[model samples]
Target: MVSMRSALRTAPALAALLLVLTGCGDSGPAAYGTDDRTITVDHGEKFTLKVPANPELGQNWYLASPRADAGVLKYRGDREDTGDGDGTQFFDFTALSRGKATVKLLFCPYGRCHSADEVASKPVPTATGTPKDSDQEAAYYLYTITVR
Candidate 1:
């Protein structure tokens, strides 16, 4: 039979081993969609915003504006599709601090319809280089993120 003192001594070491094993696993990033109006994330956590886009048709999504003063979020990177041809665009971000930030994405015929300089402008330029015209309009997406 095992002594009480021996079991007590082994319990703590077993508990510590379990904690190390569980904490080593990767849970991956959290995902959000367009339907989600707002998202809440913890600081240092990674998250992804998936949107519908078709680069082959010249209709693509690009980051138009990100909250510069908030300083609570950081843009990691992005990917176009996952070999499924579902026209999915993945935008990655990391929560840096406890605050709120807004991300704006514009869907338009980027390369075929506008110049690189035009797309890089603060307020994204219209497709036709015209103002207030339906032909120049592009779809817009806005996401508000709150980090805690």
Candidate 2:
């Protein structure tokens, strides 16, 4: 019941489709999360940082360090908030040059963080000073990135 002619015609079409689906040998940028030890990216490549957040409850994540400067990473866009209830915040960035940069983020309740500089200046809350269960202050997450 097999037809050699039909198989041959579909083979070339399937091969072309496969190439498109596989991106035609294009490898995109890499991504990393808070748990990653240290992130490394290439200049002109994009990267993302995702952190847990609950905007509905007035808790959100804020970028806290490295004000935009030449020869360093730059914020590509605003955080993309996703999910319901406790969700995640996606921060996108692009490596501008070959250098090292530290990214600090803070998770603060509503009215806590008005600016990145304000958030960066404050000390990371301590269990003793702001008991973990306390409904005051904010928490921090830091990541170091090297661009090549």
Candidate 3:
């Protein structure tokens, strides 16, 4: 019957629509991503690199003002876990070179470089001082990085 055929076709269409709408769940680390790529950032003062909770594949991210010689900053996370929302993770790079700093983020696992499209940068401040420290200066710098 034409009705039966139409019903079958509609079912498949609806199923496809659901999948598209929901999108493939992020099974990897809660890295910054819009669809498939991943993103990481450097908060400036500390070498501890930061990454967005949900990273999309094949997107761009940055760590502002990275050391000219400093290599890519890496992040590790549980593969089987994803949470209610993206959570930020930080890593320390205190001993590394200091100055305007940016960190490189790869698309794949580990430090694998994936071209200019897969990295993000953030500026690292020279120092972070507390108000209680009389020697602390009020000067500070800001940097921005994005991961699509």
The TM-scores, one per candidate, come to: 0.63, 0.69, 0.24
Worst 10 residues of 2 by lDDT: 126-135
Rank by lDDT, descending?
A: 2, 1, 3
Measured by lDDT, the strongest candidate is: 2
- lDDT of candidate model 1 versus the reference: 0.69
Query: Which residue window of length 10 is worst by lDDT in model 3?
Result: 134-143
RMSD to the hidden true structure, all candidates: 7.1, 4.9, 16.4
> What TM-score quantifies how close candidate 2 is to the native fold?
0.69
Which candidate would rank higher by TM-score, 1 or 2? 2
Q: What is candidate 1's lDDT per residue for 43-112, written digit by digit as tens?
A: 9999998876657656566776544234798898888783555477888999999998888766564344
TM-score order of candidates, top first: 2, 1, 3
Output the number of the TM-score-best candidate. Answer: 2
Per-residue lDDT over 30-127 for candidate 2, one digit per residue giving the tens place of the 0 to 100 score: 65655663798889988888766667766677776655444688887656565766677777889999988877667676657756667666676622
Question: Model 3 over residues 1-148: C-alpha lDDT tens digits?
Answer: 5798789879989998898788767342233322222223333322334433233322222333232334332222223222454434333343232233333332222233333333334232332332123112211222223321
Question: Which RMSD does model 2 reach against the true structure?
Answer: 4.9
Per-prediction tally of clashes:
0, 0, 39
